[model samples]
Target: MKQKDLIAVFDNDRDLVKAIGTLKENNIPVKDVWTPFPVHDVLKMLGRESRLPYFSVAAGVGAVIVTFAFLYYTAVIDYPIRYGGKPYFAFPSFVVIIFLLTILLTFISTVIVFQVRTGLFPGKEAEVPVTGTTDDKFVISVGSKEGLADEIITEAQVILSANGAVEITEQER
Candidate 1:
């Protein structure tokens, strides 16, 4: 379903961040933000955080444990080899392969988890809220048509404009 949103565009990151801060202070709920480069403060202001890193860490740890367990089983139980007076359970030799596999699995799991969480896949249609958002523009989108009162929307637009929004418009998102 399409929903109407009030979008404020800014030419610089400062204006965008300032507008977000002001809107937040006014108790206005911002739907989303878009920018060519990430603005670290904006994420904090919006109370948004990503769990991808935690997932990556878990994947890396699991990979290491599974790889080490498999190596131990194969070397000691499945096929015990006593050659050159070397120990059957070689720990040092497994380090390199374990490290490599952990890295590989972590990378793959992070990508897969991000894609799944974001609902992104190959050949998916792009949803661009405004032009130049992926280039030099920063956009702050406020969902307006559904739950927000018209008075609040108007107040939000005024706040955005006062805080240096270059342009503000309403569109169905």
Candidate 2:
């Protein structure tokens, strides 16, 4: 089933934090937060683990393993070719190929993983819940549930305004 969502925009990290704190303090459920650049203490404010770095590490490891395996299989088993008196399974020479392959694989894999995880990819229309959120602004989104969207939107508007937010707007989808 398609899920409905609400997006609320804020002007800065300070206001964003205050809005989030108020929501949590009042037992509101925030689905996610979006910002263009890193915000100090934002994760702590939201009580969220940093998943992007973990995903990057995993992608790097996978890239290394895949590069090593492909080079190993091609050089030692599939079609061994000796050159310059070096052994068919020359480990030193393989280093260059492995390193290059690892870098390429890592970059591509990381981008793909990030896109999938964040629902951002080519051909997908960009969703800027709040235009300013990507430029010195912050956004908080709450999933729409039965009989709760209006309440959440209202509370968010009030909390954001009270916290010095320059502007607040509710977006429905």
Q: In TM-score terms, which candidate is top?
A: 1
Per-residue C-alpha lDDT of model 1 across residues 1-173, encoded as one tens digit per residue: 55667989999999898899899888998999999998889988888878788888899999999889988898899999977788998788889989998899889889999999999999998777887998999999987446577788899989999989989998764
Scored by CA lDDT, what does every candidate get?
Answer: 0.88, 0.74
Pairing residues by index, what is the TM-score of model 2? 0.72
Give one digit per residue, the lDDT tens place, for model 2 in 55-146: 77787788778878898899899999887998988899878887887788778877777788778867997677767766877888865455
Could you say which candidate leads in lDDT? 1
User: Candidate 2 local accuracy as lDDT?
Assistant: 0.74
Task: Pick out the ten consecutive residues of candidate 1 with the lowest summed lDDT.
Answer: 143-152
Q: Would you list the clashing residue pairs of candidate 2?
A: none
> How large is the C-alpha RMSD of every model relative to the true structure?
2.0, 3.9
Please give each candidate's TM-score: 0.93, 0.72
Error of 1 at 43 (Å): 1.5
